[model samples]
Target: MFRGEHIGELVGNPGPARDAFPIEADTYERLDDEFYAGRIETLTASEQDLLLATAACTYPPLETADIRQRSAKSDGNINVLMGRLTEQGVLYRVQKGQYEYTAPKFHEHLIRRTGSLPR
Candidate 1:
């Protein structure tokens, strides 16, 4: 038994497996400020509408149908708009389970521009 224990010690510890969880900050502030400024130039009126709509931040398992019922058209048009805003860094996705909105700047702008009460 002692010799077996020594042999096991020579080898590596065999314990439960361990996994790594990585967190990444995806801010774009490091890029030339001018570049981002130029790229984010005033959003179009249509884009603004879409942003506000998506900024509503619906969760998953809560069908897009529910979102459409609350706001503007929920057709493929809205789907495309959501994808575009997400790509622009205006939106952040939380992949744990539910889909919540993470667009503070965009949401604030929408509120100020429309002077609407929080939903």
Candidate 2:
């Protein structure tokens, strides 16, 4: 954490006289991806919250119990909602009975639909 006044001291030499510097090409490219190419279709607040909650959990494979505890939604409702989210490519069926974030895997699909990658 170099402060404005400590930049020269920290570097053990005089710092650049110019205050503004251009970003490296790779860094600028990453910014472009995040700002434009990485944007996903806007999700409803509820869906976004669900995704975050799922990410927080460590339980092997999410079960109705997990939803009941974290989301407090009815068992049947959770099941139905999970199915819909998976079908929508927002969630991935990792195994016969497990799931993972499909964000990285289904990013292509999301990009195709929304014309941008998912955040």
Candidate 3:
């Protein structure tokens, strides 16, 4: 899991700065697609539903309680599901009992795939 500080370092420091950074657009896209597919494949039906519900949230980095309510799941179920999602690299802990998607665009991706909007 990437910490906030690590993300800051990546953006703030460009090692061996150059006029133009090399961008392997195709490779990056392929890898991203594969990652998305792989994560999706590992999820159970209920897990997938929970993920979609989380994605539908307008405000993010939600607390466990918020996610549980949104998904209409019990506390214990939400805890387990969140633990699994975090392990799968689909979500990241922002702080204790708070989490957000690992990728900024992941929520949008889920929304598109599930055809679900924030309630």
Q: Model-by-model lDDT, in order?
A: 0.46, 0.52, 0.73
lDDT of 3: 0.73
Tell me the tens digit of each residue's lDDT in model 1 across 45-91. Answer: 65557655533444332234544655665577766655665576655
Q: How many angstroms is residue 83 displaced in model 1 relative to the true structure, after the best TM-score fit?
A: 0.2
Candidate 2: which pairs clash? 38-117
- 10 residues in a row with least lDDT, candidate 2: 105-114
**TM-score winner between candidates 1 and 3:** 3
Q: Which tens-of-lDDT digit does each residue in 4-43 have in candidate 2?
A: 8876564443455332234455554564466433423355
Candidate 3 stretches greater than 4 Å from native = 1-35
Q: What are the per-residue Cα lDDT tens digits for candidate 3 across 70-100?
A: 7788888888988998998888889888888
The top-ranked prediction according to lDDT is 3
Per-prediction TM-score, please?
Answer: 0.44, 0.45, 0.63
* RMSD over all Cα atoms, model 2: 9.6
